[model samples]
Target chain A: MKFSPLVDELIKSLQCLPGVGPRSAQRMAFHLLERDRNGGGKLGDSVSRAMSEVGHCQQCRTFTEQELCQICSNPKRTESGQLCVVESPADLLAIESAGQYSGQYFVLMGHLSPLDGIGPDDIGLDRLETTLSEGEWREIILATNPTVEGEATAQYIADIAHDCDVKVTRIAHGVPVGGELEYVDGTTLALSFSGRTAV
Target chain B: MKFSPLVDELIKSLQCLPGVGPRSAQRMAFHLLERDRNGGGKLGDSVSRAMSEVGHCQQCRTFTEQELCQICSNPKRTESGQLCVVESPADLLAIESAGQYSGQYFVLMGHLSPLDGIGPDDIGLDRLETTLSEGEWREIILATNPTVEGEATAQYIADIAHDCDVKVTRIAHGVPVGGELEYVDGTTLALSFSGRTAV
Candidate 1:
């Protein structure tokens, strides 16, 4: 009923992936062992190589092979001192895919979680302060998600920006563009009404 | 807008997993890089080791490190001449988890997909024929799925069984337990009616 030791290890390691439970992990292991060893090998190599090579960008804290992330290193992104602060690298990627934000980024990598003992220091808040103190940015955009923790993190960063004499702005919070009013939650509806602007 | 070359390769390779798409692949890659690099390394090592060391069982074509799979090598499993043929190792694991079957297994890996250029040999059917010719089995259970390709594969194997003077049996096709009749499809209904038992 159990797999061999090597298979078991692979399955166990797969559980580290978000949303993958034991059953799915087992399925992934069996799929690799049975059908596509080459793919599995490539995946393994990539994981190891990337993990060893990739580190936080010295400037923005996003993952990068070099000292600074590509975005932070680019000369074209520096003209506008409009910086976007996001909760994680994935969030940074989402904004990058939009292709509209030419501003640079600062990745928090995690939100402030007081209950879990994750303080500002845990999420590179000190580094963010050092970046803010440089006084290069004219405007800072808080693009964290609309969760309670995200809001708290934005407020904390906003206060820091005010201290540095930088203008701070929060991304809009409302019903999503394609979302139906009937299905939108109460808080979002209230925020939409409160944050509404002239058409 | 684009990940570095190493990050991009990792994202692409993670897509080799079943049900993972581009977005999820990126999420997985970031998870490994940011949170669980040690786990990622272990997963990579396990995948490489499993792929290189594991090969098809000489007896049943299931994955194994040795010449024969654990089931085939076990003395307790050899007493019965019942062989359950399935489409993939995942299916074999499903049956083994049920803990009722006392016999062995044969993993076909895939069904006869003529459209995809997968013939009998593609699923190791020749090896199956050779095993059938040995005349060791009292009954061969065709436990392939009920899809069209699966049915064709089972029928083709049944003919081979008939030629070898071995009895062939198909697993029952019935309304699933706890399923409502109103939602059961037509073909399933027909098969359930035709295969109804005295109970």
Candidate 2:
């Protein structure tokens, strides 16, 4: 579809969002232009403000305006001395929404991918090591995904925690909450059965 | 997930986009804060600039920074004296991308919805009447959607065009390209069969 240069640029810029495609971007651009200029203005201003103000937290590497994120800075959260290591801020937010985890978090920013040139230091693994050594953590939860890279990263961090005499635990992997057993994949079914607990 | 006030506001503001819910908004917010600050900044600036600069064309009611849209202002396009009336700017873009039509367009911005308090005047039908009266046109193409409201609007506009002794045509609605007859809905199948033409 043909758009003015300004509208064209806006549509292209919107594609940076995950899962948004060219058609969806066009729809968003027209929506902003036609019905919701006020909403568009607010979105623009908020995005700019967030981009400029947000930065990595000093302790956990999560996005925050201050040096430490809300979770890292809060004394109540730190009292648990239980830390969860995650692959990204989105994962951290997911755990937070579950409302079960009371401990603090350490975000890896990304999983290790040697082919992609991301190694030990690239995802702040060295910082993670230092944090493990310094903190008096009773246990460390490796909440990374169950992909091959996630497993490798978890193992590497587990070795580091072992060296520091800290306990390391991996979050369980199994069939998803709503998945039917018949429709579940073989690997997930096996993992769910093997990781089964007493009823 | 609990976010700082600024982050929360940004996520909330992002929900104005069509099909984006709270989860997608949160993901978008975190993405901007983490990986795509530059894109976020650019989108914000572009949205504001478009909102402030873009306005409806005086003649056709389509969006443009100038008093008249590119199509309306172009001397070559106006000479055809063929006007295509559409529901919104998106529909105009879709037709323009097809590159078959050389005529100009008039955007209604919305369909007539009586329950929602929208009427003929609300969608600039009066302005359309004025434009039709002033212009020397061969035909008026009613390019609104094929829904009930669309048919009503097209009939209403056709009545007006009839008064002006202007020929009115409705865009054909039939089986879509690549549509399988077995899978086609009853209404669409009926419409396609009824609108059939001899080869």
Candidate 3:
């Protein structure tokens, strides 16, 4: 609090951001003040500008300053068939970083949780249906995380998509690559044993 | 560019701040997207606001959103007749955390560096003279770091304040508590030996 008002406020404000403890916030505060005055200022400007400029792309929920995100606006991406579903923009980001998938994404901000009163409508399942109903989708890949709620959500969606002609599949979650048989957890080992294939 | 745009941009922006390397940037980026959404947003907002709103206080050069910093504006602090000069706001924060110094600060923002083309005017030495000339100051504590530039800066200020009736002093830097004598630098050991007092 003995710091300048701006310094104090900046440190305290950063404390609100997730995972940013008071000590880290103080370190950040010092960093901004001691170095990177221009870059830090530019980042602030960018954050506000991006916040105001970027909106969810009409087709996908990716962060974009324009009406369409760069990926959605690009003509190179496939116009039909492939669609990947994810839990949040963060997950979509992870997939994009891999650069392995060349398809579109549907982001559900949260997982379905009936216990928390979150129903199918709460996580964009209706939107998924509407998009599928457009008859543009071919293979719908459920790329949500391999957690309890994620599995349940995938199952529920798989049932609903069964009425349509689109081929529905959930992303596999088994033993990691190069993992030892002894190191694999019970769930993963069970999944691996059940999902085993011919040599 | 290999990272997601959001992650890449945030990481790049983070590099501008002091002490944040690739590791800290990655952690901070993940934190913003995942852990502390509200706090992260708040930190971003605070930074944006502070960068735009707060600037160097006209008198002491400390950052403040107002025309004057809180220390400058407060009547009680002014009456203390004490001015603690430091190289940066980080130093000011450190001293304040120590809670021993309740006096006002004159943050130089940078140390004296002739090779770097830095001069006294660049670091507010001229301003300090004007403030000292007002004859309100009693004690002046030179709290610069023990670096070469810091020592030189302190000596330079002491020279200028020679004629003033104020008591000028430099903080000692020698063997730290729990420091092994063998680990102490020869220079520090010399100072400790020379500055030794009779018990």
Candidate 4:
């Protein structure tokens, strides 16, 4: 009636991934069994090792197997005296890929959502405050997502940064580059108008 | 600039799954590392175990950890004197889910593809021939997909079954039961008309 017990278990366990459902899980399991056994074995080992070994970097709260993440440990990154606060490691990577900012980052791991009972300390804001106070940073950039929770998180961290005598700035919100104004949402259009430059 | 070595490797390894690209791989890796380490660990163990232990069923060629799959091992399944041939385990599962077929199955694992150099043996047709010649089936049902290669494969197997002195039947091709006539493609519509059964 169903796949063998081990196959069924593999399919079920694969559903734990984000956006994967029963059908996708089945396809993935079959794909591994039928086509790419070597890749599957490697995936299994890598996932196991990463799960057991990877931990949060003590300095920036980003994922790493070491005491500090690569970016956090780099002295050149600290010389910029600018700290970018992001909700997750993915967000940090997005900013890093832009190749514009060379400052250090502090990963929140998640934004504050009081309705869900998540508070500042839950997102590692206390640690952010400690870093802001101890480090000779000239500016703290709030680079969290533009969502309500991300905004609230940024504001809370901004207040903490102000108390630590660091100038706080939020990333500018506006129409994305190469975006057509006609297709832009009302809220984003309004923000673009309000935040427009003199040029 | 990049994730830690372990994290990077996890992301890359995760991409081995079908339909997963770089972005999805990164998301999966981070999700496992951040929120579902327990699930990730379980998935790792399950995948590893399945890859190492699961092998083709000696009788039906479906994936199994045992010499014979459940259906092949069941005495009652052989009572119908019918064997359904399908392209993959997923197809077998689909037919089984319909609850209409109690007959045994022969999983081809893939259809015949000459351009890609996949011969009959590559899809285990040689094994299928052995089964067809040895089993006491009154009829062999060809349930391969309606695609070009699948149809060719079904035709080839039908010939083999005929040579083995067993009656062969192909599952009827037509518009799907719930699909709208206007939305159905020309080939399916034509098949539906041609394959219509009189009340």
Query: What's each prediction's TM-score?
Result: 0.90, 0.92, 0.79, 0.96
Q: Model 1 captures what fraction of native contacts?
A: 0.69
lDDT of 1: 0.89
Candidate 1's residue-wise lDDT over A15-132, tens digit each? 9888799988988888777667889989988888888898888888888888988898899898999999999988988898888899899999999999999999988889889889
Q: Pick the candidate with the highest DockQ.
A: 4
Report lDDT per candidate.
0.89, 0.89, 0.76, 0.93
| Candidate 4 TM-score, true structure as reference | 0.96
- Cα lDDT tens digits, model 1, B42-135, are 8878777887887788989887777887788898887898999999877888889888898988899899999999999999999999999975
lDDT of 3 by residue, B77-147 (tens): 87888999999876777887888888888989898999999999999999998888775888899999888
Summing lDDT over every window of 10 consecutive residues in candidate 2 chain B, give the lowest-scoring window.
B1-10
Q: lDDT per residue, candidate 3, A1-199, as tens digits?
A: 4666667888887666445677777777767755656777877765444344444566666555456666666666657668888887668767887888887777776788999998999887887888888857779899988899998988888877786678998776788898898988999889878888789
Ranking by TM-score: 4, 2, 1, 3
Better of 3 and 4 by TM-score: 4
- What local lDDT does model 1 show for residue A176? 91
Scoring the B chain of model 4 against the true B chain gives a TM-score of 0.97
After superposition, candidate 1 runs with Cα above 4 Å error: A33-35, A175-199
Backbone clash pairs for candidate 4 read none
Taking the tens digit of each residue's C-alpha lDDT, what string does model 4 give over B68-129?
99999999999999999999999999999999999999999999999999999999889888
Candidate 4 ranges with C-alpha deviation above 4 Å: none
Ranking by DockQ: 4, 2, 1, 3
DockQ of 4: 0.88
TM-score of 3: 0.79
